[model samples]
Target: MTASGLPMPGGTGGERELLEQWLDLHRATLAAKCEGLSDEQLRRTSAPPSGLTLLGLVRHLADVERHWFRRMWRDEDSAPLYCTETDRALGFVVTEADTGAEALAVWRREVDRARKAAAERALDEVAVHPRRTDWQTSLRWMYLHMIGEYARHNGHADLLRERIDGATGF
Candidate 1:
């Protein structure tokens, strides 16, 4: 288990298995960071000038998962779950009615879709880039990119959680 009481990724496994394990661990870490916080607390910004919050991160990550896995990788005709074309940063701006539970539900659904998409293809199989249509990348690259993204954001989550209530851990 991690310091946050979430299960850690296994030490030994195949490359794909290990990658998925690490990704799951990071996902759990993010969830653990938001544990025990009220809806209002989850929406609290990390600092005065920044809009970063646990709920915002959850919403953003759900969009990320949907973009990469369903839209880009699976070639599904999906739209953004939270943001609009005019306001691309809407995920980071929580309203009075936006609750942590709703955000988490969306995140979990996207994660399930991502796993299904990944399972349908080999890691070495190439997927078209969402923005750069001419460019293609392997599933392995996508997994690694997501892991790095989560790791970086999880660090931010750690600090944000600490600032919220003096709680800190992996």
Candidate 2:
């Protein structure tokens, strides 16, 4: 178990299993950052000039998971969850009305869908990049990219959580 009371991923596993386990660990880390915080607290910005918040990170990551796993990897024609053509920062702009529970649920659903999509294919399978149409990458690359993405954002989440109530840990 981690200091946050979430189960840490095992040190031993196959490549795919290990990657998934690490991803899950990061997911749980994000959730732990929000644990015991109120909806208002979850929506609280890190500072006056910044719009970043724990709830916003949850929403943004949900959209990111859907985009990468379902849309890009699976070639589904899904739209963005919180972002739009006009407003790309919607996910990072939480209001007082937004509930942390709903955002967490959506994030969990996206993570589950992403895992299912990844499980359906081999790590060597290639997918076309959504933006870079001429480029292709393997599922392994996608997993690594997602791991990096979560790691970077989780750092931000850590800071935000610390700012909220001084709770900090891996």
Candidate number of the best lDDT: 1
Model 2 global lDDT (CA atoms, 0 to 1): 0.88
**lDDT, candidate 1, 1-170, per-residue tens:** 76657878889989999999999999999999988899999999988789889999999899889988998778998889988756768877888799999999999999999999999989999988766889998999999999998999999999999999998886
How does candidate 1 score on lDDT? 0.90
The TM-scores of all predictions, comma-separated, are: 0.94, 0.93
Error of 1 at 32 (Å): 0.3
The digit string of per-residue lDDT tens for model 2 on 12-80 reads: 979998888888888888888888899999988887778899999999999989988998778998788
Residue ranges of candidate 2 with Cα displaced over 4 Å: 85-87
RMSD of each: 1.3, 1.5
